[model samples]
Target: MSTTSNPYRGFRYPAEIINQAVWLYHYFSLSLREVELILAARGIVVSYETIREWSLRFGRTYANSLKRRRPRPGDKWFLDEVFVRIRGKLHYLWRAVDQQGNVLDVLVQSRRNKTAAKRFFRKLLKGLYYVPRVIVTDKLGSYRAAKREILPGIEHRQSRYLNNRCEVSHQPTRRRECHMRRFKSVRQAQQFLATHTRIHNHFQLRRHRLTASEHRAARDHAFVAWRDATGTALIG
Candidate 1:
């Protein structure tokens, strides 16, 4: 919960109604109406508009909850971008991922120019105690400029195939976009992507890299951390 005062204090719905609304709308990639329909199916009647209001009011709260739960970003980062359409126009999503491919931060902006690129770089660089060597990125000129400016020294390379690792990591975002029918606005895209990235990092285990039993153990441990962090998701 935010340290800010509650705007919903004067509202009619109960707190759980708001929380559940945000949860369903976010966790399932559901539209406000879809969340209402899903809950109605479970005998909880609520209007889609109500769900929308809840989502707008509580989306940050939900994101904050997951942020507090998420593990710190790992070292050795890869960077990439994906094309997205926001309000019938083109936009780019800049993302940073750790060596394990856990998304560290996400930014949605109108252009991938130096200014936008600098903003994205700052977002990733903030809160980091150490610098990552071997920064991987595409042939984008903006990345070249920004990397040279902000991260002067470490080994920044522009290999063609080197960034394929980050490119492949965009698969989940693409998969989820099909369900969302595309994001309506930049704000919505940023909010949803930020929360989604954190959630994805929480569940992503190096299953393919580990043996079956080892993978299972890693997954179980990740789930335990998730449960403890959220104070939900019973381990038994």
Candidate 2:
């Protein structure tokens, strides 16, 4: 097992509170002040600014630790891109997920042209260090042009309906964008979304496909894994 050392050095609050604060912010489409309100309701008084600091500090660490424990991604990858507003300008958020709905990677770029598509494709493949058997994407000409240059050997399927898995995956990000009133900058959107995807993936159990007992067991397992990943036991 790959162990992650605690990154919460010299922190006044316990690791549990810190982890929970980060979790509530990333795992849900809640704002910093909203998280503060929620924690206050539970009798744990903490400022929203502090919560933001904790998120910026420990969010990436926790996400990286969780990624280390994730299973190898499925062979069929679904790729998609959506426009996000940053500082009143448009940027493209490129994302990929496997057949099992496991997020492979995300990238924010200024354009959605052939060059942008190629860059995002390379980044996703390089980060994973593995090639997919097939890639499903919308009928974006840039995708075809980019795929030919990047991984021509891989099968590419183009159909808007066939790529529903990736389309559905963007809903959470859309919700988060609304909650934050749109991202302030491209870098900020990339950082927050990257961390958010990992944490969301960790807890997304597809409960609809599970029996009640199985759902409970799966949820408990996810929490245990989260505790291990954050190196903090959540206390009631």
Candidate 3:
């Protein structure tokens, strides 16, 4: 339990309700209305609009708190970019993940050129304490150009198959995109995906690699971490 000041101070709802609402929205592909109905089923009468407001206000706060508690990321980084149509306009979604499939960062840009690649590289390095040992990407020449200037000493592997980890990681974004009926703006897409990746990845234990009991333990640990991140663990 923590002695820190309450994050839920002044809110109409208690920390537990807010925490559960935020968790449900991010941990699954559920909409705000879906979360509202779920809460209503439990006798909690909250509107979907309020749920949306809570998500917009508190999602990133919780995500950043969780990021501070994660262990150092893996040294092998996989970078990839995919085109997303926002409001019928094209935008690039840049993503980086470590070897273990943990998302490092995500950037939404208008181009996949060298400048965009360089910017994404800088964003990744700015958050990390150490440079990666290696970076894998598809045959994107911008990555090669960016790496030469930004990560001169690290190994860069360009292959269509070597970076499947990052490519597969895009599936969740795609699913969410479809669920949301497509993103309305670049900023909205970036903000939602940035927070979504952190919170979703926090609970994404690779159950296939763990025994049944181990999976349960990992899930319990994830819940505890979520509690700590959202300041709900401090609640008596």
Candidate 4:
């Protein structure tokens, strides 16, 4: 059996329930208790704590599976950073996304200096098969400094208006942070957001840009991909 088939081997609850619970929590701004209540309304009596455990254990696994299945990221990369307050300590969330709005990666760090920027660049390029043709960012000197050392040959565009795509991408993270009453720690924030972005972006069809039938087709394709990632066999 494939390794994907083994993740829920010892779990008592069915894989469907676990998959649905994790999906509801991460794909939406729902809390663990909210997910518990949603499942309870469907006659499943799982506790919020159990749901939390499920998320921590299996969320990254599912996300990785989906990432492996996604198409190659766009060559035009847009990078941005936003401050996140965890327990009154300010940290920066460095995020990279493609021109198509696909999240490339995210890193949470204590600083936004050149060192932090270089670290984020390295993380972003770690698994990428090809380097980006152009990197766009706001007028941040760190990006300029880091790009010189890390991505020396790539084009770097610095403009506030041109980077709105990356800036807008941060809105979802902000919403999720508020919904969770802010993350408890740096590690927690990093782990959760890493999984959250992948899963969230997977299902985020550009409906406005797609026709209704095209939208439905994209959504159905997304569901099929989700089932494959979760190792949930289709029901006849």
lDDT, model 2, position 183: 93
lDDT, candidate 4, at 150: 95
The local distance difference test score of each candidate is: 0.74, 0.90, 0.93, 0.92
Best candidate according to lDDT: 3
The segments of candidate 4 whose C-alpha lies over 4 angstroms from its true place after superposition are 1-5, 234-236
Compared with the true structure, model 4 gives a TM-score of 0.97
TM-score of each: 0.77, 0.95, 0.98, 0.97
Residues 1-236, candidate 1, lDDT per residue (tens digit)?
Answer: 43344445687866655655665665555667788888889788889987777766666655666666666767677888889998789999988887778777788999999998889888877746567876888888998899889888868878778888688777778877888789989988988788766656566676778999998998888756644443333212
Candidate 3 per-residue lDDT, tens place, 1-236, comes to 23567767799999899989999999899999999999999999999999999999899999999999999999999999999999999999999999999999999999999999999999999999689999999998999999999999999999999999999999989999999999999899999999999999999999999999999999999998989888888787
Query: Which of 1 and 3 is the better model by TM-score?
Result: 3
Question: Model 2: clashing residue pairs?
Answer: none
lDDT of 4 by residue, 49-133 (tens): 9999999998998898899999999999999999999999999999999999999999999999999999999998896767899
Top candidate by TM-score: 3
Give candidate 3's TM-score.
Answer: 0.98
Question: Candidates 1 and 3: which is better by lDDT?
Answer: 3
User: Tens-digit lDDT track for model 2 on 1-236?
Assistant: 13344456688888889999999999988899999999999999999999999999889888988888788999999999999989999899999999989898899999999999999988987778899999999999999999999998999999989999998999999999998899998889989999999999889999889999999999999999899888875332
